[model samples]
Target: MIIIDAGHGGVDPGANGHGVTEKDWTLEVSLHQYHFLRKLGIQCKVTRDRDVLLTPERRAALVKQSGAKVCISNHYNAGGGSGAEVIQSIYSKSKLAKQAADALMAAGMPVRRVFSRKGTAGDYYYMHRLTGSVETIIVEYGFLDSAIDMKKLSIRSFRLQLAEEAALAAVKYSRGVENSLYVVQSGAYYAKDKAEKLCEELKQKGYEAFVRRMN
Candidate 1:
């Protein structure tokens, strides 16, 4: 089961972006994810079904009561920044989490860093106190007010694309579980050979490296 928490509803909008309320967008995106999950035959529940305020403890308790297998807290980014990040609490661990993280990386989020505290996943909210499951992550999709992210939002299909992306990931991770890590190096260069050369230099520096070609 998936618990989708649309952060800061009711009185709390969390953050404002280009005149769009954070609460509204979060709820819309969360609902989209929920519907997509159901279409995939995945079970899910939301913290607030509508515009009701929920305390952190209350939200966490809801998750615990639902016997959910995973938790995803939906939120947006603020300021002049945009991208996606998955934040895990310091209390949960499971193969599903790792797979979910990798899927997010492949989903074309601005940032692809998975944060965990000692293999446990949760963010800076009620997720840790409430989640007793194997996988729990906070999804900060992108910055709302930033120039780059605002442009992304202007696209009618970005949020839906995100929902589709995350839904596919959730299906892969929570259902089709896999475990392992691969060496993925990131850099910028004009030519593919430059990347290959960098990989070679790193190998000489006593680190395992591989050159990946990109079109």
Candidate 2:
């Protein structure tokens, strides 16, 4: 099983810029990843599903309790950086982090780096140090303070795409499958009419298309 931790919530708003709040954006991405993983037949759990506060200690405890082998703590960066980054636990290798960085890069998000930080005690982040045996990864989707990042992250479609890609990376890492099969999806829409319209357009362009409802 994999655990998805949406960083910051409630009173802790995290980073905020360009009309986007870190807590809300992280939750949205985490929820999308959770559902996408489930659809792929992968067991998954999320730390918080709504606008609620969860301390670092509490979030780490939940990840350990879940017995999930992998925990993804999602956050939007702030500190003037313009690219995505994946921080792996110092104890873990860079495999998963590299995969995540690659996915973000493929989606046109610049990747700052895939590396681990260390504190005087041990792992730099609480999510890694306190999460017991779970392999915890801190993913900074992009810097919320940067206009370049917000330009893409502000779009619902782009955020959903990132969620799916992150989920896929987790699935690949946990399953140890180098050649996993992936489905090509054009888009995900909330409105049935919008989806059907896309389907019709695809069909008209000499492609086989259908609108499948998501439960």
lDDT of 1: 0.69
What are the per-residue Cα lDDT tens digits for candidate 2 across 125-208? Answer: 998899999988899999889989889888888888887787788878888978654666788999999998998898799765
- In candidate 1, what are the lDDT values of residues 76-155, reduced to their tens digit? 87866567667777655545445555565575556645666442333455576456653667777778887777777656
Per-prediction tally of clashes:
4, 0
Query: Model 2: clashing residue pairs?
Result: none
Instruction: At residue 33, give the lDDT of candidate 1.
Output: 79
Relative to the true structure, how large is the alpha-carbon lDDT of every model? 0.69, 0.87
lDDT of 1 at 129: 48
Clashing residue pairs, candidate 1?
88-121, 88-122, 89-121, 89-122
TM for candidate 2 is 0.85
In model 1, state the lDDT of residue 17: 79
